[model samples]
Target chain A: MTIDPAAPPPRPPGRPRSREADEAILAAALDLLIERGGGATSIEQIARRAGVTRATVYRRFPNLTGLLVRAIEWEYRNTTPEALSWPDVPAMVRDWARHLSEPRSRRLVRRLYGTVDDLPELLRAYDAAYGSHRGRAVRNTLEHASAAGELPLHCDPETLQLVLSGAALQHLAAYPDTTAAQDVEAYFLAVLRQVGFPSPPPAHSTPPRRSTSR
Target chain B: MTIDPAAPPPRPPGRPRSREADEAILAAALDLLIERGGGATSIEQIARRAGVTRATVYRRFPNLTGLLVRAIEWEYRNTTPEALSWPDVPAMVRDWARHLSEPRSRRLVRRLYGTVDDLPELLRAYDAAYGSHRGRAVRNTLEHASAAGELPLHCDPETLQLVLSGAALQHLAAYPDTTAAQDVEAYFLAVLRQVGFPSPPPAHSTPPRRSTSR
Candidate 1:
């Protein structure tokens, strides 16, 4: 809970209970929603996790379903439509690797897809969030790369993005279970190497572009 | 219904009402299942489509729900676990291209994906059907390509399959309104070209083998 330091003074001696309780409740709800699928997650459980009284939770959300809708909305409040000012190409590359490696991010993906069978509406919302939010930034960064002559001369921006994201999406779908971070790292590196990233190229050895062994 | 020539021939009485009715019902049920989707499609609609009495439809399938399950099964009766007996790699390649281009195949894919939201159980069954029935053959064919020394030295069979199928799957999911055959043919060809298919390489030189333009 962030208080507006410039505009607001302390209302009273006690902490800001409303904002703190709201954040805690949403965060805890998010955790349970992802970790426990739909059926096991309940308002009581969210209240226990948030360490707020049931009355406090009820005040914000009348029921469990309503809380779930809000929890997802809260989680997505700051998600950039795409990569936002990712420093540079290398940082952007590293960003993808880090997401796969980190426990929380992986769990988030697992939790999202894990609900597809049981809660298709939730999955639909997830798709809407996932599609526009992060895609634009990555696309912008890739376009910048092409403009800067950092990509192959013939590279189509959409095609390159499709290859990179599409390849990763396949693995993510095939293995909904938590993946090994190291394996994912290795996989990312290999994908980059194969695609022939122009800057800070990994190795000298890549196959002939137009091979014909048939 | 085929009459065995060696055995007693069919009595020249009349058409087999039961078998004919069953086939007509199943065909109509499939059409409605895919066209109208799960909601509006009902036993009454199916009976009308089949030009059969409501009683005849009921005798064939006791209820609408039971009919839906059987309709999917009937549609998949001829599906091979993989490309059944292709002449060569090009033929195997053509197999995928044809599937994407042909109306029936594309419609089948569209209908299957279109059901994910409203009919999750059907989708789950579809995953089971699609997974086991087709994945093995593609995997086998790709392995054969690698064994033939036609793949890039650094190629991973699994990754290649993932990229090809995953990329195509993404497009197929996005556009279900029967994509133009030429567009799909081009898409399939581009996918194969990028994947570095060695057999009968296409015109035009490719990018630098180990491009480091930066």
Candidate 2:
């Protein structure tokens, strides 16, 4: 697995795990996860695909479940809670919207959700590692926006979280095939409007409007 | 499966299916569905649980898959698309909000979503049955509300659908504990505001307000 550069170094041990072996195993597991999914992907298959010995793969990850978890984290490294841990509402929303608008992102989300029912451990692990990441991302970003005077002082972070996650879930439902940036923006604008946001026409053009009168 | 009251009756030769037998089997299947979920529940378990022979259950449902579908319909008959086919945004919103506010309803939704990944057919059956029910319900209701001049004439049904589903999905996330009517209504009102609806205090009170002098 690709460790974050900022993360502390691996713990001291008698023999260190091979960095190259770790990458190959994770890469193989990641592909199987998407192609075959949770219940179907096997450690044996991962070993074969990675061209690594089963003993070597098991030595690093300990079990198939642990390996799968590491693979998920590795594949979706860009979507990690830490990656979205910043506090810029528009930037975060735009970033999130753009990412989720992709078909591949939708598939990844679907795969994750597909397993949430059958794999309780995965959900629990995600809740801890990601801090229930989707909700946290929107809540933190909106809170920052409200504090920054970009949103109403009384903007309800909880409600904004609701709008965000809700749109995301339904996006998987109604617009699963939609990968265009404009489509994501339409949904994003609709959400901002729902929360009483005085949305800028573009990210950089949020001018205040004067009420038109005859 | 039990046909809707308006739906035409099933045809021809064989002796009529016993109402009591159908109810018992459905009740058993529903309980098992919630208790064990889609994967673990089976025709054998359902037959044993209902105190009916395997042949009897199979005769009515054809297979475990069909039985599960009927059970879903049976458990959620009240929330079925036919039940919400009418166009009354306020009433529809109230009903939808109330249904979603129930803990049982949330559990049901979670269970259904939990299986959507592995069981594409379940999702397909629901989409066909409900006509993407969440979006359709919101759109139909908003159409009525708009025509009645209760909301802005320019209100977008598709956008409203997005907001409603977004809120519902978020409800599944952050507000799993919220069963209050007021909580659902709070989210509902935010959606109305997004659409520029001059929301009345209640269904009975929609008086136009005079602008206050500063």
Interface RMSD of each: 6.3, 3.6
Model 2 Cα shift for residue B195 (angstroms): 6.0
Error of 2 at A201 (Å): 3.8
DockQ of each: 0.13, 0.28
The positional error of residue A101 in candidate 1, measured at the CA in angstroms, is: 11
C-alpha lDDT of candidate 1 relative to the true structure: 0.66
lDDT per residue for candidate 1 within A45-107, as digits (tens), equals 999999988898998896886677677777777776344557555666667656666666555
Q: Whose DockQ is greatest here?
A: 2
What is the CA-based DockQ of model 2? 0.28
Steric collisions counted per model: 7, 2
The most accurate candidate by TM-score is 2
Q: A99-124 in candidate 2: lDDT tens per residue?
A: 77777656656656656656655555
Q: State in Å the error of residue A148, model 2.
A: 5.0
- My TM-score estimates for the predictions, one after another, are 0.57, 0.69
